[model samples]
Every structure is written in C-alpha cells, then in structure tokens.
Target: MAKLIALNKPFGVICQFSGDNNTLSDYVDIPNIYPAGRLDKDSEGLVILTDDGKLQNLISNPKYNKTKTYVVQVEGEISDDVASSLQKGVQLKDGNTKPARVKIIEEPSWLWVRTPPIRIRKNIPTSWIEISISEGKNRQIRRMTASVGFPTLRLIRTKIDKWHLGDITSGSYVTL
Candidate 1:
C-alpha cells in the first residue's frame, strides 16, 4: 500500500533528502518516500511525501491546479490596491500568474515562532495576508509580494488542496 505523509518543514531545512544542511532525511526515516512538492529552504510549512509516483504528480503538477494556501507576513501594511492587484494576478518574469484568492488576515494564533526569527524594523509595520494560488511556480509567492512593493518577511503554507498543515508540529510528520 502507498503511504502519504504531511511534514511540517521548518525554516533552514533543505527540501531534498540528502545534503550537508538539514534535510528531510533528518526527520523522515521512511524508505522510498519523496516530497511531492518542494518549499524553498527559507520558507516553512506543509510538505506532502509519498512513495507513489502518480500521487506525487497529482499533488505537484500545476495541471491539477491544487489550491495551496500561504500565510504571508510582509514588510509593510498591505493596501487595498495591493490586495486587489494580487487577486488579479501580478505579472512576473515568467509571465502573468493565474488569478489568486487573496485577503488581508490577522496573524494566525496557531503560527509558531520561527527559529532565528524574521528581522524587524522599529518604524516599519508588518501585515499578514492570506494568498491561495493554484499554480506552483518557483518562489512565486515571494516574487509576487516583492513586485507589489511589500517584500515577504515570512511565509508559511497552511494548506494544500484537501490536505492541510493542521495541528502538525514543526519538524514532524503525520501519516495519512
């Protein structure tokens, strides 16, 4: 039988199974399972792992259009115009992204304090926004925020399609 696991990948952990830095293998002792999709080393949150190749494609492939939700903490207070701009799909170097669902949200209480923490400026205020995008582009969220004048200070994936980060603790996995 195929096994599916959701791992809460922490900041600084490499997405690959093997490397000099902290890698999936450090936390996952399972055999043959690979990450369905990847998160950048600086980004943290839910990573789905599976031994089934077909299942992996279904989750990772942009064609499937799985809705991936991210909670982002950006450097400045988000304006209504910026929120609208993101929802309308901002153009990138690759091209215009698909329209995304975006809204300003309060900092989630469930959010864990990041180790090494994000830098803070005394005068600048930060805002939280929830963004859900169906397309999985390389560093898409980070790029999008940067293009709109507010750079993302921190980002966390809270959900991927039907699967979610849920009550899973950082650096741990929940088998589903």
Candidate 2:
C-alpha cells in the first residue's frame, strides 16, 4: 500500500524531490517518492507525491480528466471573447488543447505572494481569473492567455480534484 502526500509548493521550487539544486528536496525529504503531477517551477500550490506507481499514473494521466484549477493573475483585461476561446480550447504550437473552464475571479482569499513577482508593465491593467484544465500541458495557461492577447502575470494552482492548498502556506507538506 502507498501513502499519499499533498504539498503546497512555493514559487521558485522545482517539482522534483531531487535533481537540480532548485528543487523540492530542499524543503521536504522523502525517500523513494516522486511527484504524481507537476506544478511549474514558476507556479504555486497543491501537488501530490507518492511511492505508489499506480496512484502516480492515476493522477498524471490525462485520460482520467482529473481537472486542475489554477488562479491566474494576468497583465490585461480578460475579454469575453478570450474567455470563450479558452473555454472552447486554445490552439498551441504543440496542438489544440482540450477545452478549459475559465472565469473571472476575485483574488484568492488565502493568496500568498510568489517569491519573485511576475513582470508588470506600469500602464497595463491586471485581473484575476480561475482556469481549470483536464490536460496538464506545459505553460498551457500562459500560452493560452498570450494567444488571446492577455499575457499571464502570476499563476497559482488552487486545487486538483478533491485536493486543495487550503490553509497550507508555501513550502508546507501534509499527509492525507
């Protein structure tokens, strides 16, 4: 049997337990464990790690349609057309992504600042949005917004299915 570990990854930390110096090893020390899914080094929030291969596959595999929700702060207004396009699916260089659930949202109640804040232009407006996707594509949220002319400023994953960051602060780990 395998135990599930849920971690609230802080910004600037890599997903791997070991590897580059900029990784999770510096925070949590778990032997023979690997992350079930990845949260980009620049992104933050709930991540799962486990020793169980079966459970790892279950979480990482897109076939499960395990929806992951992210709260993204972007550099410009989120137009209805862009919101609709994201819901329909954004065409990426790799290919068209699966449709996503996107909506304007207030800043998360439990929001924490990322280590290094995202780049900002003094004149451009910014907004918060919640985007949920079944497929864990690389830089998908950033690319999707850029494609629609609103570049992402900060992205934080709030929940993945039943797992959520909740009150966990950056670099904290909890066993469930």
Clashes of 1: 0
Lowest-lDDT window of 10 residues in candidate 1? 12-21
Error of 1 at 128 (Å): 0.3
RMSD of 1: 0.7
Question: Best lDDT goes to which candidate?
Answer: 1
TM-score of 2: 0.94
Q: What is the lDDT of residue 114 in candidate 1?
A: 96
Pairs of residues at least 3 apart in sequence or in different chains that clash in candidate 2: none
lDDT (Cα, tens digit) per residue for candidate 2, span 1-176: 79788888888888886686879898778788888888888888889889999999999898998999998998887877778999999889999999899998877777877668777788988988899999977888989989988888888888888888788778888887
Evaluated against the true structure, the overall lDDT of model 2 is 0.86
Query: Taking the tens digit of each residue's C-alpha lDDT, what string does model 1 give over 1-176?
Result: 89999999999999989887699999999999999999999999999999999999999999999999999999999998999999999999999999999999999999998998999999999999999999988999999999999999999998999999999999999999
Query: For model 2, what is the alpha-carbon lDDT of residue 18?
Result: 63
